[model samples]
Target: MGRILDQPYDVNLQVTAVLSKLSLLPHPHLHEYLLDPYISLAPGCRSLFSVIVRVVGDLMLRIHRIPEFTPKLLLVRKRLLGLEPEGINIDHVTLLEGVIVLEEFCKELAAIAFVKYHAAASSSP
Candidate 1:
């Protein structure tokens, strides 16, 4: 197969389009199918895959505000970036924990938005 950078934009666009609204669906039976390829790519492609995942995650977060999906999305991030057990280094553990904390932060923001937007709107006359 060709390298990720060879067609980064197209791949990013396609993956983003397919996955952006995935959080709205039930948990997929096979998760991150599109991402499997990136994990096995050369190290140089990792950064490009990271960007692709970030874009997809951002789109999901912004559009859905489903706090439950945060961790799953980050897991995909960790996997695609080789931060999972098979590829993980001791030094990367802290990085993984930092990301989990960031996911918690995003969930808190979503909760805040629900209270400020949905709850407030519903309470109004």
Candidate 2:
């Protein structure tokens, strides 16, 4: 997820937007550290901490109401849990772009999270 922001302009607008929103952490330094790979952090505890903080911050931001998804998600939830059991049917054709963007976003986040673990494990021995 962090790397997506550094990609060229040809990247998908929805993916960029999602990444932007996700990386909007409360502290400027922390947010900048995550988005900017050039910023140097010491290689042991601080480096690991920064990665953990960024991933956690991104996850926290994702739980809030995103304008593009909140209404639709609420409707879907209502339909599933409320009176309209049949309304769980979604129009995938219309939602294809959103679905793809979300898929990419999830994959990116997973990659970012796992990379830290992998790097740490590889360095240990």
Best of the candidates, lDDT: 2
Q: lDDT per residue, candidate 1, 20-94, as tens digits? A: 344223343222332222345555544323654564465444435434455655664666567865443332333
List the lowest-lDDT window of 10 residues for candidate 2. Answer: 91-100
Model 2: per-residue lDDT, tens digit, 7-115? 3323545554655465544455655454544567665534423544565565456535345465555565455346456535453322333334444555665565466
Worst lDDT 10-window in candidate 1: 28-37
Total backbone collisions for each predicted model? 0, 0
Listed in order, each prediction's TM-score against the native is: 0.29, 0.29
Candidate 1 ranges with C-alpha deviation above 4 Å: 1-89
Residue 15 displacement (Å), model 1: 33
